[model samples]
Target: MQPAFTRERVGVHAADMVHGITAVTDAWQPGRTVDVSAAMQSVTARVTARTLFSTSIGDQDVTDIQHCLVVLFSGVYRRMTAPLGLWEKLPTPGNRRFRAAHDRLRGLIHRIVRTHRRTADAHDDLLTALAAAHGDGPGDSLSDRELCDQVMTLLVAGTEPTGHALAWAVHLIATHPEVEARLHAETDRVLAGRRLPELADLPRLEYTGRVFTEVLRLYPPGWMFTRTTTCETELAGRALPRGADVLYSPYALHRDPRLFAEPGIFDPDRWHPDRARSVPRGAFIPFGAGNRKCIGEHFGTVEALLALSTLCARWRLRPVPGAEVRPRPETTLGTGPLPMLAHPRAPG
Candidate 1:
């Protein structure tokens, strides 16, 4: 799975991201209000489907997936916040809905895996790579069930968080004219009148990259995660027994004044190479740390950089007047129903 998301492999999927962003931008009309969150989610979902399965999933399928995710994640949040796990065992309405959504999503993934296995070598995508991978031991080979589980994990991880982070970037750009101006300038200079950005142009879009890094720092999609101690450990002079469940919030860590100057400000320059190194290790863990770090980190970053550059190049999305735009922290920190009007940018 890690090999499937290496920088070189991820670069092969750049065209998929370009196509997805084009589809979204093509549907946008001047002054038409678009749900930025939903639109970003649709773009990422399409891109992930193509890159992961070597097939295009219909708009309706994306919608169905999103609906199931919403139901399932809300249930997870409930279980996480509750004091005891006993309620989860009960067949309550919430629990029932969660189980149904889980089954529905799993069934879809299983069908996809079965279909892909028939023509495994015909396609060049993540599924094919995983299917062909082998190791020394027989147990190293993935069973159908294991493959389905891996795909489900990648689908959820690759789609929702990246989409939500892009939505936050769009919102931040809309509200902060200074930041938006800088972003547009960088894209215009790098793209030089091109309608779409290519993987080669990533190096020149440095500011665009910083903007996204800042976006992640401010509004990381995986807002909170829980880790269990494998062995007894001590933290901040407190002793912890093995198997202790410790919950931490990247959302809170990113806002600490000690790690970042004026932490609440939407300043991209803070991510500049010189300043970026000033932040201590373990202070920035938007994608977790150690072996548990996200497998798709580089892939997600490329998708975001390309998508943001593509959108910023052709149009500016402005929050609709009087619309309330705020973070809605669920499974991911998403901006729920973010209505923004697309204004075409004047030619460079």
Candidate 2:
């Protein structure tokens, strides 16, 4: 999986990303207010589908998957944070909904995996790779059940966080005139005479990359994660027994003034090489750390940078006046409803 997401391999999906972004942006008429959050989610879902399965999912399937993911993630968060562990055992409406969503998503993945197994050679995506994988020993190769599990994890993790991060980047750029101006200038300059950005163009979009890095820092979709101790350990003069669950938040850690100057400010320049080095290694963990780090980190970043560059190249999205844009933290940090108006930009 890690090999599939390396920089060189992820570049193969750039065309899928460009297509999704174009479809979404094409529907935006001048001055028409659109829900940026929903739009970005739709784009990411389609892109993920094409990149992972080498097929286009119908609009209905996309909507169903999005709804099921929301229900499943929100339910899990509630269960994890509930004061009493017994609460989840009850047959409440929430639990019932969670079960239904879980069943539906699982069934979808199983069907897809079965279908891919039958025609694996026809596709050239992640699903095909998993289906054709071989190992030296018995049981080393993934079984159908394991394939379904991996597919589900990749589908859910790939779609939600990347979608939310793009939405947040759009919101931030819209709200900040200076940032918006700089972004437009860079996109216009780098993508000269081009309507869409390509993998070869990413290296020149330095500011756009920094903007994405800052977006992740400001609103990492996986805002909080928990880890359990494998053995007894001590931290900061406190002793922890084995199996103790410890939770850390990238959202809080990213905003620590001691680690970042003017932590509340949305300055992409903070990622400048010299300035970035001042922050300790472990202080920045938008994609987690160690062996548990996300496998799709590079893939997601490339998708985001391309999407941002393509968008800024042709249009400028401005937040609707008086529209209250607020963060909704669930399984992922999401913008609930970001209404914005798109204005076309003259070609550079």
Candidate 3:
């Protein structure tokens, strides 16, 4: 999974990212507020599907997948917070809907895998790797069910979090015009007049990178994650029995004044070269830590940076007046239909 998202592989999807961003910008009109959340999701989903499968899925297929994702995400938080998984089996309307959503997504992925096995070509994509794994033979081979699970995991994990991150980046950039100015200046200097941002240009666009890092610090999509003790252990002064579940909130830790100065503020300059290294080791985990970290960290980073530079260079997205734009935490801390007015800028 990790290898499939190497810089080389992920860079192959750069053209698709450019086209997706262009599609959104082409539809933008002055003073016409659009749902930035949905727009970002559409772009991220197209990028994910094209990069993951490298196949052309019809518009209806894309729509169906998006619908299934919404249904699945809506009930996941409740199911997780419910005691003993009791609510999951109640067969209420929501529960049934969730079950149907899960089944539909799973079945769709299974069919995708089977179709890939039959005719999918040798492409540098996640599906190809999974297909190879499934054909490893005998005890080493992944079952069809296991392959479907992997596909579902990658699809859900890859799409929503990256989409939300980009959406939040746009929102933050819009609200902070000073930072936005710096980002635009950096993009203009680094990219010159390129149609799309390249993988090699990432380092030169330092301010853009800092802006994204700040966004992650303030609103990490994986706001809360859980870990379990492998065996009986003691931490600080507490005793933890084996198999105990511990929850860590990046949302809370990122805002701890002890770790960050004026923690509530959104200051991208805090991530400057000299200042960034002074923070504590575990205090800045946007993508997570250790071996269990997200496999798509590099992939998502490249995607967000490219989208940010590409779009920020041409247009500014401002939040609509009187719109309710607040964090709605679920599987990921996300917002709903963030209405933003897009204003075009002169080309560099």
Winner of 1 and 2 under lDDT: 1
lDDT of 2 by residue, 1-348 (tens): 667788888988899899988988898999898898888887887788777778634666666776777678778778877887888889999999999999998887777788888888777888888877879987688888888888778777888899999999999998889998888888888888888888999888988888999999989898999999999999789999999999899999999988888988999998878788888888889999999998888888989999999899888888888998777888889998899999998765
* Model 3 C-alpha lDDT per residue in residues 1-348, reported as the tens digit of each score: 667877787787777777766765678887688888888877777777777667635556666777787787778889778999887889799988988989988887777778777775655567878767634557787777888877777778877898899889999888898998888888888888765677788989899998999999999999999999999998879999999999899999999999999998999989998999898999999889998888889889988898899887788788888887789788898877799888877655
User: Considering every candidate listed, which one attains the maximal TM-score?
Assistant: 3
lDDT per prediction?
Answer: 0.87, 0.86, 0.82
- lDDT for 49 in candidate 1 is 77
Best by lDDT: 1
lDDT of 2 at 279: 81
In the range 1-348, model 1's lDDT, one tens digit per residue, is 678888899989999899988887898989898888888988887888778877634566656676777676578777876777887889888899999998998887777778888977678888888877779987788888988888777777888899999999999989999999988888888888888999999999999999999999999999999899999999889999999999899999999999999999999999999999999899888899999898888999999999999999889988888999778887789988899999899646
Better of 1 and 3 by TM-score: 3
In candidate 1, stretches whose alpha carbon ends up further than 4 angstroms from where it belongs are 56-101, 133-140
Kindly state the number of residue pairs that clash in model 3: 0
TM agreement with the true structure for every prediction = 0.90, 0.91, 0.92
Clashes of each: 0, 0, 0
Q: Model 3 lDDT vs. the true structure?
A: 0.82
Model 3 spans > 4 angstroms off = 90-93, 134-139
